[model samples]
Target: MPVTPDRWNDLERLFGPRGACSGCWCMWYRIKRSEWSSNANAGNRRAFKQIVDSGGTPGLLAYVHDQPSGWVSVAPREDFSSLERSNVLKRVDDKPVWSIVCFFVSKEHRRQGLSQALLEAAVKYAAEHGATLVEGYPVDRLEGKKFSSVEAFPGSVASFRRAGFREAARRSPTRPIMRRRVRPRPKG
Candidate 1:
């Protein structure tokens, strides 16, 4: 389900007091670094809530047994200014695309293929909204190597692959830009 005003409580419960990582509130890419630093915690939470309350579907919420389990931030590429500023993650092309920038799954829900499911759902959600292409920047891990959950918050390359996304660019050793084409929903 998309994060809306009615589901604000569920989102808050899932993010907890820390705001899903040191007060990030999943606003890291939506604002400038200086602004994000100043808005950490309560400020960030309030800002995110404003987006939800204003009827913005900033992301999707995954539910498990009627409880919020995970979140994936997907939006038009322009919505994330930070991406345009990052040399490493800059636009792969001029083509319009929806970007998947973040993911957070409850500890208990980790490693259960929830991330992949969220990726798939996000693609469908974007397509429904008229996006023909969806992109993701996921961490590429070497075989048999392990990393902290925080490092995987953007997602793992394996998960993107499982979702039928193909590598579109690799400007960094461990970060790869992946893409998937979707047939947008037909208009009436």
Candidate 2:
């Protein structure tokens, strides 16, 4: 389900006290770096809550046995200011798109293909919201090399691939801009 006001506590529980990474509260891509650094924990939490309270569906939540187990931040490309400013993750074209910026799964839920499932749900969510194309910036994992979970927060290229996304651009060796076209839900 989308992260609405009533589901705030479930999201908080899923993210834990660290806000899913040093107080990110999933607001890292939504705000400027300096602001994110300053806000960190409590401020970020409140800021995110305001988004939810205002009825903005910043992302979707996944549940396991009725417990919130994962999150994926998907919104209009314009919603993430940091992406427009990133050297490696800059837009691929003028075409409008919805970007998948982050993913977090509870420790116990890791390696269970939850990330791939979340990506699929994100694409569906975006399509339902009138998106013709969905994009993701996933980290390309090298063979025989392991990276920390923090580094993999954006998600893996393989996961995106499994969700039917293809590489649209690759400015960085380890970061690939992936895209998937979605037919918007028919009007009622």
Candidate 3:
């Protein structure tokens, strides 16, 4: 199961003291740029915590046994302004979609396919939540070189493909808006 209220601690532990890369606490996409900068470390954490307290589940957490190993933020595409407002990431159509906005895994848990696991869960989340379509804006990974953690928040193209999403549009050279239509399973 995905992380719930009682498992909030796992999410906190995964973020660590620095708020999972320079005090972002994964709020980089949620808040306005100026506000994000001003709030810094503690600010983002508070913002994310408030969202959780209000029972607005922003994403899913992966645990290896008991500890939080990774996180992925998936919600209605419009919920992430940083992407919605971006010239590079414009809407493909008027169709509504749930967006997989970000991913964060503890340094110790990096490269363990947790991002993929979280994405799989995200698809399920979207499908169960009445989203007929799930979308993602992911980066194309080059061989050998690694991107800054901040830059990698959108996840890699390979990961999205691995989770059964296909490219819907590619306007940017390095970024692509991929999508998967989550058809409801037939109930007997």
Q: In candidate 1, what are the lDDT values of residues 1-188, reduced to their tens digit?
A: 88999999999999999999989998999999999999879999998999898888999999999999999999999988999898879999999999999999999999898888889889999999999999999999987889888888899998899899999999998998999999999533
- lDDT per residue for candidate 2 within 118-163, as digits (tens), equals 9988999999999999999999988888989899999998889888
**Candidate 3 lDDT, 31-73, residue by residue in tens:** 7899999998988889888888878888888878777788888
Q: Which candidate number would show the highest lDDT if scored against the true structure?
A: 2
Q: Which has the greatest TM-score?
A: 2
List candidate 1 segments past 4 Å from native. 186-188
Better of 1 and 2 by TM-score: 2
Count backbone overlaps in model 2: 0
lDDT minimum window of 10 residues, candidate 1 = 179-188
lDDT of each: 0.92, 0.93, 0.84
